[model samples]
Target chain A: MIGVFRQWLAGLPAYLWGGWGAIASLLLLLAGWEFASQWLDPLALPDPRTVLATLHGLLTEGEAWAELAITGRRALTGFALSLGVGSALGMLAGLSMTASMMARPWVTVLVGTPPIGWLVLAMLWFGASDGTPVFTVFVACFPPIFIGAMQGVRTLDGQLREMAQAFALPPLQRLFDLYLPHVLSYLFPAWITALGVSWKVVVMAELLATADGVGAALAVTRSQLDTAGTLAWIVAVVGALLAVEYLLLEPVKREVERWRTLA
Target chain B: MAHIGVTAPALELAGVGHAYGARTVLSGIDLHLPAGRIHALVGPSGCGKTTLLHLVAGLLPLQDGAIRNGFARSACMFQQPRLLPWKSALDNIALGLKARGVPRAARHAQARDQARRFGLDDTALGQYPQQLSGGMQSRVALARALVLAPDLLLLDEAFSALDVGLKAELYRQLLAEQARRPMAVLMITHDLMEAVRLAHAVWVMAPEPGRIATHFRFDDAPAQRSDAQVYARTAGLLDDATVRASFGLDAPAPAAPLALAAVGGLRC
Candidate 1:
């Protein structure tokens, strides 16, 4: 674990340097928003300054962190549950052709069902508690992770499997040394996608089925005609998602896949 | 341990037959490999030389007859390197030892030693398989098989992909390793000269119900044989009717007028 942390730490400078393009694109987006604000009514799309000021006010005085914390908890909880179950089941299913074949339509159903449709069912089932958002996030995030793991298993080279057998690798070595490393490549990308899905779905679920969260704050701002406040909530959630993805997950991914992406 | 000198543990296959559903690939196969000996199986493609090797390596199930593997441990190198792309070359070299539950530091030390002998430098050992050149990857694969000190080493066309110079260098390393440690080797190849140079015994296989057509044994140790001797022996073996038939080659035309042929000339 310490070695992993060291590698992650050693790799951080390059990783941060690679973020210049993303920072520039974000700057461009801010400029575009500022330009658009000159023509549109402030009621519809407030300029970047107004949004940033409102977001600052919410951070200092309003209960923004508490609501966001509640939403983050629900999103992460649901995402963790699905990550475990989906990856486990997907690997198991991938090992057998019959199982994966049978699982195809089920994955399709999960992926195809709109989160709004599930949110209504969740509202009916869990009422106004955290269950509605958490369950909805899980349902929304499961398919990508599952399919990623399944493909990872199925696409393993037959030659490598033969090599493993010829060398007499133990079951644990086969799992850790051979299987896990290969699966992580596919699993990591799907995890990022699933995390994005979980965040988006939880917020949507909160807006319709609950009375608190960034989504609820947005709803409150909408009712009060506070367009800047609504955008501020959006920026907070988006900014949080970007921070988690870039600062945390991306660094970990780079360290793990150093063997794959050597310069 | 069994009596030390009492019949040095050998692999004996008797009447081994294998079929994939309706199609039979191998039938009535018999072979032997005593300790510290090298046997090469030679034939055209699709001749089930690989199938027989896989059977000995326990990579495939036997459908008929019996194989008695007396070696305590064995390792295999395939036509391709087959190193784990995610693993550093050092880890790949240490894979067999790792599978045997040797501690990491010990295996890494041993692998590093063997890898250096195989012409891999420290940087190459630390790199992943994809990052290494083809020749370096092959060296790592060879080192991986040898690091375990296996009683039997299986090579399925392992060195066939290398350039002539690299092949000669590796052949020296392999023979030196074998001379020092005294382990058995079973290799597959299409090149007859390779068989003549490396193997103590060469078995030719014919496809379509694959079976051993004939076998020849050389008296001198492989390392002592000269290149001219290898060429002469390979040509001598190729002249045999059964060996030519196994390879699906037609008989030479009526003897032409004798002419003084230069060096490296076709025997035909």
Candidate 2:
């Protein structure tokens, strides 16, 4: 664990250095936003400066973190549930031809049904509770995680399996060493996608069902014609997502993938 | 070989036959490898040399006969490197030890020692298999097999895919390992001269039930044999009617050398 941590820390400088291009691109986006805001009514679209100021006010006032936490808890609870169930079921289904074949059209159906449709159904089933948003996030996020795990299992090289058997790997070693490492490459991308999906779907669910959370706050700002407040909430949500991705996940990904990735 | 006591057992096969449903790939095969001798099974592709090897290695179910593999432990190397792409070279070479439940630090230390002997540097051991060159991958694969210190080692044309230089280097490494470790080796290869240069006994297989057609023995030690002797012995083996029939290389006497050259082992 210390070795992997050291490797990640050693590679941190280059990883951060690569972020300059990202910052430049984001700054260009702010410039575009500033230009486009010149003609629009403030209610329709706020300028970037106004949005930043509003976001700063929300942070200093200290209420934004509570609402963000509520929404994060719902999204992440659902995302965690889907990540576990989807990865497990998908791998089990992939082990057999009949199971996978039966699962394909079902996966297609789940992926096809929009998150709004699921939210409506969840609201009907679970009322105005947290279940509505949590269930919606899970349903919206299941297909990609499931498919990633299934494909990972299905695409494992037969020669490696044979090699493992010939070497007589213990069951635990077979699981942790041989299977887990191979599947992780596929699972990480799917998990990231599902996490994004989870966030978006949970917000949509909360906007319609919940009386709290950042989504409810956005709904409040919408009613009051407060475009800057709405944009601030959006910025807060997006910033949180970016922080989770870059700060937490990307470092772990680099640590696991350093074998194939160049130093 | 079959008459030995259980104390120092060698690999022995008796009347072993294998059939995939109705298609028989091997039949009536009796073979033996003394504890520390090297044996090569030489045959053309589709002659079931692989199936026979698999049966001995317990990779395939035995259908018609029995194999008594009394070696304490064994490991195999395939035509491909077969290293897990996600693993570092040290981890790959340590696979068998890991399976045997050796602790991480001990296995890694042993793997590092073996990798260094195979000419892999410390940086190479830290890197993954895909990051290395093909020859380097092959070395890692060989190191993976040898780190087990098995009494028997199986090679399924493990060197046939390499260029001549790489093949020669691996051959040297194999001989050097054998000098210190003294294990029985059973390798399958289509290259008749590789068999002649490396094996104490070479068994040729013919298709359609894949029975052994000829057995050739070399009295000279493989490490001491010169390139010229290998070539001359290969030429002499090619002239045998059974060897020609097994390889489908029946040619007029004057054109025999040309036919033998085209039989695919003489390239630099």
Candidate 3:
């Protein structure tokens, strides 16, 4: 018990220093913005407290919650779809050269094209429904996960495979014992990056083509000249992203890495 | 010229030939591995000794000849342990059985049973390879190989990295375990003294597209030979003209000159 506490205490200074550094930088930026507003144009960049006040007012309104929920749902649904399809296809491609050759051109095209370009085409096909945003999110997220998984399986040690063969390990055991553990390390990072991009793309797609979401709210605020409201929605998006990263994905990543910790 | 009456041998490689691209690494190689005995394959580096071991383990397909096996299962210990860095020692040991279709509950029980025989404590089993000493990690690897109770075992310099005392200790442990259940072992090593101590029959191969140069059969019991005696016997075999030529050593003059030199017992 005492040892755990001592370890925690030793880590406290680093945590505190990081927190203070962020706060100090933010304060300096805000003070400069406020000083600039007094001397020159005020409409360019607002102070931090004004943005916080705008955030508080936005949180009290019912429409803001609805917008945030719509954006969140689209991101989750699209990310889940891409993750399932991408991982399965990636594994298949990794196992068979013919499959990889067939899929390589499409993977390259999908990853290379600008995501907004796809959103415009999706809007033309689906006519500005939730599908447009969801499809854009899928395109933005699939490539990284696919490539990571394929490379993970490809780069597995040949000696280990030979060892497995000599032992006559079944296919399932080969997957878990020799393959999956090696792949998971690469896969998790790709998944994390994919999820983050999916959220951002979903919002951008919603802003361009849809009538609902935080993106729509930002669009609405832009037309009305409600700059404070626009900043508040941006804050809300950032805060939610931070929450999901810390409370959900990071915990799962740590659990997957627990064996390493034991080492 | 040489015979051991090894009928019903555990493994037989008859006119085995393997080539990569245009270069033939092994050609017309014949070996008869007797059941429940240690056979050493000794040669200089790049003599295709490792390739032969891999062939016996069924990692490489027979290209031009036949390998008749008397055993169903074969276990291999690589030059390095080649352990899974992500897994604990016990998990690594259990991996062979898991691959062999053993159930999880039963595999852990069997792994624990084998680990205890290898002098591995529960804590040691729980730790990863990086956390264990080199000797301890090698022991775990040996346990992993032995746990499968393979009919044939192939080792590629399995103990060459250990200190002299530790290597001797591991040899004793391995022999004791083999005594409990007889296993046919084919090991490749550059250490002639080690080969002398452990091998019932040592087959020496020449370099550059390897072939069996000759063989030495130890007349003394493995338990009866001290390190010095083992070294001396192996040195005497190495003094043979063909063995010396393979290793790029200076060859003695002629049959009479070598016979006279042998009579004089000249030590270099």
* Among all candidates shown, the one with the greatest TM-score: 1
Q: Residue B175 of candidate 3: its Cα lDDT?
A: 85
In model 1, which regions exceed 4 Å deviation? B1-7, B252-268
Instruction: Report the CAPRI category for model 3.
Output: medium
The best candidate by DockQ is 1
The parts of candidate 3 lying over 4 Å away from their true place are A1-42, A95-108, A261-263, B1-9, B219-221, B252-268
DockQ of 1: 0.69
DockQ, per model, reads 0.69, 0.50, 0.54
Ranking by TM-score: 1, 2, 3
Which residue runs of candidate 2 sit more than 4 Å off their true CA positions?
A6-10, B1-4, B20-22, B251-268
Which stretch of 10 consecutive residues in model 1 chain B shows the poorest summed lDDT?
B259-268
User: Is 1 or 3 the stronger prediction by DockQ?
Assistant: 1
Give fnat for candidate 3: 0.67
* lDDT (10s digit) by residue, model 2, range A45-106: 88999999999999999989999999999999999999999999988887788999999999
lDDT of model number 3: 0.80
Docking verdict class for candidate 1: medium
For TM-score, candidate 1 versus 3, the one ahead is: 1
Worst 10 residues of 1 chain A by lDDT: A254-263
Q: What is the lDDT of residue B105 in candidate 1?
A: 99
